[model samples]
Target: MASKTSAISASLLVAGALAAPSASPADNDGRRARGEAALARITGAEGRTVVESIRRTSPELGDWIVDFAYGDVFSRPGVALCTRELATVAALTALGNAQPQLKVHVEGALNVGCKPDEIVEIIMQMAVYAGFPSALNGIAAAREVFEKKGVRTTAMEAAQPVAPAR
Candidate 1:
């Protein structure tokens, strides 16, 4: 019995050793491509203007935003870009520090197929869990994007709908 267990353990160890490395050069290239694509998608004409303003004001943080946040972290395949953007948007909105990135991610969420309504809904939901202030700040940022795109939004639209008369 002990010999059988040892043999199985050895086989498992060999299999693990033979597995491909998780972070190869190819992986890095793929990540860079995804990051560039995401950057382009998020920074549409107007969004790029926002980024340029930031770069002029804070060059170091701007580099980190492009390289680390988008390149290193977002390029990973663990989660879809839409999902990641939603989470990032919510966190930043709640933290109330990075409104610029929050707006970009909101647009990113839309570019990646998340509807404007859905983004608003996420902010509303975050309000319940993260507090009114956080949600309010998030809404403020989202409002800017909606306005830029000429999307009409109201508090009633964000609320849950009631069933109509039978």
Candidate 2:
């Protein structure tokens, strides 16, 4: 376990560009503060922005996300936030149909220090156990995320190569 974690930690250092996560002031103020901090560390700016919009339209859901998901669950010290987000990416990939949520968590995984290659490797491994279809979808989603985050991929570059011989 220690070796595995060390390997992952080493690889996560290669995370691609991602929006910085910011902690919003917890309205509840006590545990809220800690949770918000954890949330920011994991989800960063993207999570805050999306939650703010949710708060405007559905206060209950937004509150639940901040108070429960970020606050209570993520605040726990059993696992590192970096570990948590990676696990999330793996689970989402296994589900095979949660591309929307997978996309966000992939970014979150990066925000929490998961490298682009690590994310791809994680999903790629799932292909064998989770079957080609789910793995294929997971790869597609990860590719979209890499593109969105401006991480250059060989295929993407090939698709939009620089013009020459003008």
Q: For candidate 2, write residues 86-124 as lDDT tens digits.
A: 888888999998998898898888887777778888888
User: 1-166 in candidate 1: lDDT tens per residue?
Assistant: 9999999999999999889566643255565456555577756565556656777989756555656666778777889878887887878877877787788788778777777777888888887778898889899999898777676556636778789989
- How far is 14's C-alpha from truth in model 1 (Å)? 34
The candidate that achieves the highest lDDT relative to the unseen native structure = 2
| TM value for model 1 | 0.63
Taking all chains together, each candidate's TM-score versus the true structure is 0.63, 0.68
Best by TM-score: 2
Whole-model Cα lDDT of every candidate shown, in order: 0.75, 0.80
lDDT of 2 at 148: 86
**Which pairs clash in the backbone of model 2?**
15-115, 21-44, 21-45
Error of 2 at 136 (Å): 1.5
